[model samples]
Target: MALLAPPKDWYHPAAGAERLWIGIALVWCFVMSLMMPYWHFRGKQNANGTTYTVTPKDYLERTEKFVAANKVGDLNGIPIVQPAPGTDIYLLGRMWNWYPVLKLQKGETYRLHISSMDLQHGFSLQPVNMNFQVVPGYDHVLTLTPTSSGEFTIVCNEFCGIGHSTMIGKMLVE
Candidate 1:
């Protein structure tokens, strides 16, 4: 005996629904692609400004207060003066290494304050993420935001001398 088959229309239910889903998906992808480049360009422009310096104690204190008050903490474990939005920062130091390892969330924005203590050294991030010059007596600030969450290595761009490559740092973003 032959088996009976279900109705042809029943097997293909809601043909319009498939079209609607595809349309929605396309629109979403288009919007995201457009926004991603726009955000990246805007962030790059913002990162080209100056940054200020603050004492490490003051930086920690302000960060604590920001946490207590439910405000955002943008301090990156550096004793650099805070920069106003859209402004670059300049920090000065000698053979100093920033502590407390910075942690940034996805989409978070930051302006870096970098300087040297004793000799002329370099500050460079691995994977060629961003570029900044760390010179003695002169602080350089670069604005940056990690769009993705992961671990990145920070390497000295300048070749001061021996142990320059060993001067490594780490950045974490969630």
Candidate 2:
């Protein structure tokens, strides 16, 4: 019965144990808050954060040109492009698919340009686990080097529409 009842005085300083726990919780929260900024500035796993404003029409034209110029073959009606070692690679995210599968060489660094033509999308590179947001009207560039050689799948993690499940794409690193 005594335990169920409130403290005799409704207003009173917290006990020593309660104060200690409160202090520990506050310190923990402060440390967690500081870690966010520290990781944002010094983290190695972060994206390059390079983006540029672009219209969907302009980006589509540029990507189409890139695909036409560097296309080596075709796979399931999609062009398979093999760009030179130092050139930029364009990837377009449209309604239900990623355009023009990319073939990259292992150990070579290339700038990958990603953008969405219709709505916002998520670019998730499987096996590597690299993810980036693909928004319309903006071009996001990621500089990456393929460390291994095999077929890597690019899955859309964002739900755009009914066909989002079929939005899987591919990258061939040789």
Candidate 3:
């Protein structure tokens, strides 16, 4: 037991190499801290630091009504909502579907309101590589401006349920 006992002088001096590593880590941490405020002020950044003012039910009803009034028909079995520029657009995420494929114009910005109906889903826009986590209660609003005119696919990158792989949506910029 004495052979395994700890040394009385436990405070050993660290090498210069170890001190250099600690100094580098402290500097790196300070630089990363500035990114928080930078992203918060810049609206162009894709960051979710918002809260839902209304419940999911209320949000869903609003989306449903919007879809009903502004329905432009279906694209590949998904309902298409052609909203004007600067208008608030809703994209609901459910068990295995993303309702109402959105249609927007290029070079124009639009407010995209996204949420979930049942469970959390993934709101991913292809070609541009934009992705957002769709929560049930929180309504995440994303301001998007399509620079290119084409048909882009929306993929459900988050695994929600058994049929998650088939959960696909569409977005058209014209």
Candidate No. with top TM-score: 3
lDDT of 3 by residue, 106-147 (tens): 999888899988888988888888888888888888777888
List candidate 1 segments past 4 Å from native. Answer: 1-47, 51-100
> Candidate 1's residue-wise lDDT over 129-166, tens digit each?
66667654444566666677777667766776676666
Residues 34-150, candidate 2, lDDT per residue (tens digit)?
988888789655576589999999999999999989999987888999999878999999888999899999999889999999989899999998899999999999887888899
TM-scores vs. true structure, each candidate: 0.48, 0.80, 0.82
What value of lDDT does candidate 1 attain over all alpha carbons?
Answer: 0.55
Error of 3 at 173 (Å): 1.2
- Comparing 1 and 3 on lDDT, the stronger one: 3
Q: Rank the candidates by lDDT, best first.
A: 2, 3, 1
Give the Cα error of residue 2 in candidate 3, in Å: 16
Model 3 quality (TM-score): 0.82
- Candidate that beats the other on TM-score, 2 or 3, i.e. the better one: 3
User: Where does candidate 3 clash, by residue pair?
Assistant: none
